[model samples]
Target chain A: MAIRSSLWLEYQIEANWTSPVIFILYNTLKPVGGSLLLLAMYYVVTGGFLGGEGLYFLYIGNAFYMLVAQTLFSVGWIIHDDREHYQTMKYLYISPLSYFTYLMGRSAMRFLLSLLPLSVLIGLGILLKIPYRIEILLLIGTFFLGWIFVISAGLLLSGVNMLTARHGNSIGQAFSGIFYLFSGVVFPIHVLPGWASTAALGLPSTYWFSLVRRSVLGKEVDSIMSGFTTGDVAVRLIIISVLFFVISYLTFRLADYLARKKGIIDMSTTY
Target chain B: MNVMLNLRALKGRAYPRMIGAVREPSWMFWDTFLPILSMAAYIYVYRSLDAPKEFEGFVVLGGVMTTYWMNVLWGMASQLYWEKETANLQLYLAAPMSKMSILAGMALGGMFSTSVRCISIILIGIVIFKVEFVVTSVGLLLGIFGVTLVALYGMGMVFASLFLMWGREAWHLNMIMEEPIYFLSGYSFPVKALGSLSAFATVIPFTLGLDAMRQLTFPSMAAQWGLVSPHLELGILLVMSITLLYVARLSLDRMERMGRSKGTLTMRWQ
Candidate 1:
């Protein structure tokens, strides 16, 4: 079952990349390049103690924050695109395959695919002379948390997409905008005034950035919940992740129930 | 008769779009809300921290003005891109009027419509946040407004043309502008945080427009304007706007020729 689903995910990804949608897909990465160029300019102007190499502390914190930040941006569209292309929601319901398994496989493939630009840009960071010890274990630890946050959010959204379909993409895009604004990606959460900071704190992406900042800049975590050890954050992340994952699964079931109630789950993405 | 005819077309063009604009409340609300939230979020955060009222007021107003400026200018530039790809351009081109009139009509109409959002922000800022209007230097403010508007729309036309010539790479460029321009504008943070190493950060129109608006609101800041305005800031906005307008027209003209030949060209993008 795993092998079959993995292969199916591969086929979907290959198809997405082989056509005009590649431009649309890469449009999702537009910020990564701009972020690179912006950081370069920032270093050039603010160099040393104030701006340059001395400020690498803030840079690492913010950059790592933005990576998960970018992931949370439009990754929900993995299924939205699938639904649009194949009207696959209905097909999923009727098929013998498990819905979560299928979607997870597809997301895993896309998660890898989306990371390509980020990996390249990470190398570009080295080219930019942003130094780091390159702690793989710590990196993967945070990446796992980020991935869990993102995948769960995407699932809930994908479940929403199962209902909204093509229009679901718009809703997903809207969340992406909100994510950029609220997440401490572009600016520090502490910089925000009052209510905005409260609202931002609720987003898991904020916590993901907190973790990423801790991992990358070797910065101390500020939030009590944020300062947990890798195993600690992971455990908490898993508990919260399970809730979201369950919510999404149950939401998809609700979506399926409603679709079955309405007689639309059988329809393909072509509509 | 020719002048009168174009004038009539312009009036007709502007009014219909103005009415059509309000029909899409979701887009309007969001286009306004996204920037407002971004700015408001900061204001709320700062107030929570008990930051000085003056500094908060200044950043909030700067954000409001900068956000509106970006939306208007970007909307103008992206009109064609939006219109063309969705296959809506063809329908507009086929309308019974001059293409230039229609293009001008769309551009003017967009400017007038979105300006309503800007005005609303100003009112909200004054009422809720006590962002003083500082109308003490209306004449200077007017001059600044004129320069800022001209610079914004002109560069917008330039970016709008990118869609015609480049098709989709135009979007790539547009997306790139979103974050970098915000920082360069110095809407949230002090100008010093931009770092002194590069003058390039100071010159973007977004930063210039914010500087002008800031000075206008607090006319006393006119002396300190030198800190923000180093002349190159003025030059870049001026030079870029005119040059971009010219480039945009050239690109459109090339499109015109090709479109005429192909006999399947659509109206210029919105």
Candidate 2:
């Protein structure tokens, strides 16, 4: 019930200000713009659109990344949005609802909202006749795992935001930017240097994106994770996701305690 | 007395932004670090395609100019809306001196902070990426850079007034300005890559400014990438700067009148 209520509230906050048509258009424009930027880069370098393989690889990777980026930012920014912008964090804390669940509700809504862009991208891929050898089962599994990884990271960010006085919003951008680089979102992980690639291996996002690309592109495209079997990826994703969940849960608990003790949880530093 | 008040208001509003970088290590760190990550990602993309070494320089220069574009859009353009939401707009309007001074102060401070980020990116590109630049004429480079900033910030001032009038729509508008502008402005690639599309793109000061800088810096690569000659682009930027600033003053006067009559100037949480 709390989650449902929170979802409705979040929807109102995000969409109520604009006409439904305009809101959808705004959502559509941002992701489409982002993809076009990548496409422009690809075209400039290749000198033409001679090869669809590289384009498809980048397109699929970038589309799925929106889920991680949006969920991470939405959940992370909620702390600042409520405390600083809306001034409702204290009221929310005193409510009967579980704050963690409220955040998860928000995270889930963002992931759902992100699906619009994902669909638009996939639809474009089909329209352009980019071959997609999709395995429905693997695609679903990859999405579930990606959501777990994003939420955990977002939870960790929320915990950190609880302690900051100003610019808690930037925390989301910092995390998303790091993931864009390390997660092989727009390129292969092997493209990174030895140490950086090694660091990428530690992140669940690496395996998550690899599986997402594989689920759509199949094993035809070569990648660092091309050698791993579907089962191997599933096992690694589960392990890393669980590790992140435990860490983020514990961090949020500690942050919650510290924030209450310090009396700064509802502090606003807009200046 | 009025001139002194405007000058004092400008300094007063500018103080925090200039000092914020020094006072907050984390903000400075993220501002410098996050842009580099994206720049590095693009650098790798160009490398993977086996593009020439000069392409790395193109991406680096794009990253530098991007800092200014972001500051103009987020800092100057959307700032009035932010101030309104925070209940600070009423105070600003209620205070003596012109509101344009507040925006001028914001532009000045944002330029300083953005310059720090730009210089850092350039140095990192040189030391780490080993990107090289050719400067045939320092005067030409400086001329374009100055005019581009003036034009860009002048547009930002106009947007600030419009944003105050638009309220909630301003946030969405700002988001639209970001990645789309990056593509249209050829932030990570040559504007000429867009072909006939480059003509429409020239309305954005960054588009011509970035192309002009690239031609000056990478003369050999410029033939393939240059949309227009450097002098023509600079001439366009000069005209744009003058026109935009004049339009900005007119818009501010209109916005103040509309806000006063509509009773929306002090409105919050709309």
Candidate 3:
């Protein structure tokens, strides 16, 4: 883990310039930035600053949605990219350490690296007169757990891709889009009909967004989930993180071994 | 005499790329689901609005229309981009076929796979979501789809041309143009809800496509106002698609002449 972490930190200092990374950042900025612009346009269109009562909620919700969604998705994208490029995976295969340690460190660094896009979103939120501050430890803890869970999920997907080697650049991107719908990222999960709402209910990301909405906007989610206390929420997330690591490691180790047997490890990184 | 032989060789080359693209389940799976899932999200979200609005059925068609064109355009454009970076592109180029024949293979594969998804989504929306469908004329709905297919794929060639020239930078920037516009164009939301001054109508194709779709969804809106003109929108998109495709073709011609693809993995901080 130590060696892997050190290598990844050095590696990320370099990956920070890729166009997709920039693309992700650009996409992050547009929604919040565009919303603030829409606020201006709303004034132009409706002839008022605070056009309607719910628009503020929409702004705050969308902004919070943007932060959690982007961070989680970026984590997935980074880890997926690692598997695709096989840059990390190369070292990961030959590392003098447990694969879990290697996977965790890579995921951790990528998870932290994903925070780059949020800077602009945070700036846009503050600029727009919406409340978008990080509330210290709890906010940090929420982000940490959320990012950890997301990265672990990414690691698990990485393991699958390790075997199949049938990687799609957009899997991370697509998974995020799919999850965004559920995790109250783009639209509130509350608004989703029974099947999708129930489908989203099973994901840890939904809970992550719940905590974000609570910490940021303090909106009541009574309409969404019932009888889940704050303490239960924390417990559930920790369990999710653990579940991800334990299960993913097994799949990853098996895939690693199989890929080696088949000599797929030496394959070109292009696809 | 040589031209006849070249045509046969072209057939030999282009046929595989088409069949192979379809045979790959991954391509078809995404084509099937991505559009439906995207449309389903809108259908899911709009339930919160006040029930008096008759926007649901109209909006669903627009959402489906947006998905259809997006798949055709984005799919076809990206196929070229994918072929470029990956080693397979060289393989395709090295084949004995003419470039246009090869491109036709790509366009056909993409369109066939995506249309399956589009039609399936419309069915799911109607069946699962209970989205209302009153077919005054299946002919009109089919007409919109026809125009959308030609315009979208033609414009896709236009987008693909830029990729052939400038590479990833143009490709990334161009992709952003597809989805964000859907929202602005009033695919999911009502044009009435778009505020009186939001001249999205003046600028975008969805405005016209959505109007044609709305004719099927809410004929009264079309019958009464005529302010929401379907023919005008379709005509504009048709012209725009041709113009975009023409520009794209020119760009591709230049790119093929240049023949420079730097496949370097630039180190960038994430």
DockQ of each: 0.12, 0.57, 0.20
Q: After superposition, how far is residue B186 of candidate 2 from its true place, in Å?
A: 1.0
The TM-score of predicted model 3 comes to 0.77
Candidate 2 docking classification: medium
Decoy 1 TM-score against native = 0.68
Ranking by TM-score: 2, 3, 1
Which residue runs does candidate 3 get wrong by more than 4 Å? A1-61, A64-119, A122-134, A163-169, A184-201, A224-226, A257-271, B1-31, B51-54, B69-74, B90-97, B191-207, B220-228, B260-270
Off by over 4 Å in 2: A50-52, A165-171, A220-222
Q: What digit string (tens of lDDT, one per residue) describes model 1 on residues A1-271?
A: 8546754764554343335566445533554534543454343334433334323533454455445434443445555444443346566656787777776666565555556556655665665566555656777877777777666766776666555433112244344546555765545565554686788766766666556655665553343334456566555556766776778678877875675687655433211
The candidate scoring highest on TM-score is 2
**Model 3 score (lDDT):** 0.56
lDDT of 1 at A19: 53
Better of 2 and 3 by lDDT: 2
Candidate 3 residue A57 C-alpha distance from true site, Å = 5.5
- Worst 10-residue lDDT window for candidate 2 chain B reads B21-30
Name the weakest run of 10 consecutive residues (lDDT summed) in model 2 chain A: A165-174
- Model 2 misses residue B227 by how many Å? 0.9
Query: Can you write out model 3's per-residue Cα lDDT over A1-271, one digit (the tens) per residue?
Result: 4756744753454344356657565555435443443343233234455434334444544555444443443444443344443346566557777655654565555455446545565565554565544456667788778766676666666665555433233444444556556665545666776787788767777777666656665443436643566667677768866786678667777877787788776454332
- For candidate 3, the per-residue lDDT at B245 reads 62
Chain B in candidate 2 has what TM-score?
0.97
| Tens digit per residue, CA lDDT, model 2, B1-270 | 499999999998888877866666666655677768878888877776677899889999999988888788778888888888778888988998888899999889888878888999999899988999999889999999999999999999999999989967887688778777888888888989888988999999999999999999999988888998999999999999999999999998899899999999878777
